[model samples]
Target: MTDARVMRDRQASVASAARRLDDASGQHSGAALVQTKAVGAYPAAASAYYACTPLRIDGPETEGAAVTFTGDPSRIIMALNLGSRIPPVGTRLIIHSSGGRWAFRYDG
Candidate 1:
């Protein structure tokens, strides 16, 4: 499936995941797709993030090849999803943690 479609699906799945997380933790932690609007013009960054967190997406990004990075993020996860390229399984990612509302974006 296309990255956009994957992101759209993630948006839908996040709702249910959030509910499940809340049910398990008893805390409200919302999920969203980090979009180009928040990141930049390229979808690579968004896609990279999508591979990481479980954020809801609301826009489109540059199309071509792409890469995804997914794992536990005690911080921010960054990636460059472009073209049809995909990150290898078990790739490490970088994250930046700030005291703010927690959000996630995943495209898998």
Candidate 2:
């Protein structure tokens, strides 16, 4: 009986730990900001092919380098890191990731 109780407790602890980890992972995965830019009148299918290049966002006392797309500066978008979801359309941001440049759109 005592052994069975101990096993049950251990299983419960493990499940709790797993739930905590899952919550943390979800929180870490999401869009952080939006950016915007304008581009030539190309088909919507070509929007996802925009090339991203490294650039710096200047500040008064600090400068941060980030990846930016080359194109019209009027379209809005957002920036996200790896594992983060892409922001919805109309929202603009410049995302930075270790992986190569790519674009994402929210399905829902």
Candidate 3:
């Protein structure tokens, strides 16, 4: 039989893991895939923000490769579904994770 202290620790660890799973797999989700909008023809660049409505995608990203980033510019552009007004190539994307603890811009 495990010691009382070990049992308590195991319980705590399991509880912690459950909480994280719920948080990451919640209704709002943790990491979001964003699509930037076209600012205009001026400056030749657009902002990395301007979130859109979730397409009610319920499967994994791989299940929806037509929406996720697949390293192919055309695929991402079509996946964004922002309309033909968007630039032919992809736009700048600055992802902020961990409550703003990490942020980096992706121009490719």
Candidate 4:
């Protein structure tokens, strides 16, 4: 019957559309996996601990004195030079002057 044939053709079209959609979904997943792998391959930076008491210094306007944190003096230091107008010794600062750095200290 013509109705049966029409129904079969419609079913075939629906199945084809489903297959294409499935293929697109698979490609999207593959692309996402590749991106994740690429990001994971890069090395992450090490974190430095901030000192409770920060040192205050005096110097020129251009450069600020380096205030080293308590735990790791060598590793962590306020890159701001001595004269740079920075927050007080004990104030916590997200050091934007240099690289994206962070520190906390009010007085010392």
Per-candidate clash tally: 21, 24, 0, 13
How high is the lDDT of residue 13 in model 1?
80
Candidate 2 or 3, higher lDDT? Answer: 2
Local accuracy of candidate 3 as per-residue lDDT tens digits, 10-32 = 89987765554322114434444
The sequence of per-residue lDDT tens digits that candidate 2 reaches over residues 1-108 is: 699999999899877654433211144223223343323442244234332222233335535545543333433332222333433334444443222222444332
Highest TM-score against the true fold, candidate:
3
- Rank candidates, TM-score, best first: 3, 2, 4, 1
lDDT per residue (tens digit) for residues 1-108 in model 1: 999999999898877654434311134433323322233332433334333433322244667545443322333334344324433433332222223223232343
Error of 3 at 88 (Å): 16
- Model 3, which residues run further than 4 Å from truth? 23-55, 58-108
lDDT of 3 at 7: 93
Model 2 Cα displacement at 75 (Å)? 12
RMSD of 4: 22.3
**Deviation in angstroms for 83 in model 4?**
52
Please give the TM-score that candidate 1 achieves against the real structure: 0.21
lDDT for position 4 in model 1: 100
Question: What lDDT would candidate 4 get against the real structure?
Answer: 0.31
Better of 1 and 4 by lDDT: 1
List the lowest-lDDT window of 10 residues for candidate 2. Answer: 22-31
Off by over 4 Å in 1: 24-108
Per-candidate TM-scores read 0.21, 0.25, 0.26, 0.22
